[model samples]
Target: MKKVLVVILVAFIILQFFPIDKTNPAPTPGMDFLTIKKTPPETAEMIRTSCYDCHSNETAYPWYSNFAPASWFLKNHINEGRKHLNFSTFATYEPKRQLHKLEECIEMVGKKEMPLESYFVGHQDAKLTDEQRKLLIDYFKREKAETERKMSF
Candidate 1:
């Protein structure tokens, strides 16, 4: 049992040397949300602080992301989030997809389902106050409506 325990500890230590990649994917020109839309600075900052880590190509990886298991988790989350909505590739999506993503964004923020709770453990600043939530929720609704209107034409 003692030998087994030591071996497991050593294996875990060794795994740390094989840390997961935390590098942000290179941004593509003409496709990114910022490039396609004129975002308000305050809203952009809020989105950057709250959602970009997992959702965009601008993830600000922290020190813990250098560790093996944690890095693995972070990488998985980033991948999954991008699949759902990659702001970095927003305009590259079909127009209907773009509108659907905007609608989903509104639903997620309105229900407090985004910026997942696990994310908040390491990112207290991502916490949205009631006022902030309202602001974002309203913004998301308006964006969704505008996108829908544009798509209709």
Candidate 2:
């Protein structure tokens, strides 16, 4: 038992040196969704708190993000989240894809599937009130309508 414990401790210590890269690339103005859409201040704040960490290029990493196993997990989740929907690169997506993603965003928020429960566990502020959810859903609907209107013309 003593030898096993020693090995585990050594492994934990060694793993700390194998840190995952958490540095975010510089944000480009053209890449921002807000630049193209009318994002209300309150709604923007909610998104910043709840979604930006994973969904945007400007991820404000927590201190624990520098720690070993947690760092690896955070890096992986962030990468996956960005792959699915990167608000930072919203303009880069094709119009059809953007429309689809916006719809999905509304559905996820409406169903309370966003900000992932695990994320809210550490970030209480990320939890959305019913009103916030409605606001987000409305925002997505408006954006979708505008996009469709523009495409029709």
Best by the TM-score measure:
2
Candidate 1 on 50-148: residue-level lDDT in tens?
Answer: 988888888888888888787898889899998999888898888788878988888888788987988898899999887888898888777778888
Which 10 consecutive residues of model 2 have the lowest summed lDDT? 29-38
Which one wins on lDDT? 2
Which residue pairs does candidate 2 place in steric collision?
A: none
lDDT of 2 by residue, 8-48 (tens): 99999998999888789789878788776868888888888
Q: Could you tell me the lDDT of residue 146 within candidate 1? A: 80
Global lDDT of model 2: 0.89
Q: Rate the local accuracy (lDDT) of all candidates.
A: 0.84, 0.89
TM-score of 1: 0.91
Q: How many pairs collide in each candidate, listed in order?
A: 0, 0
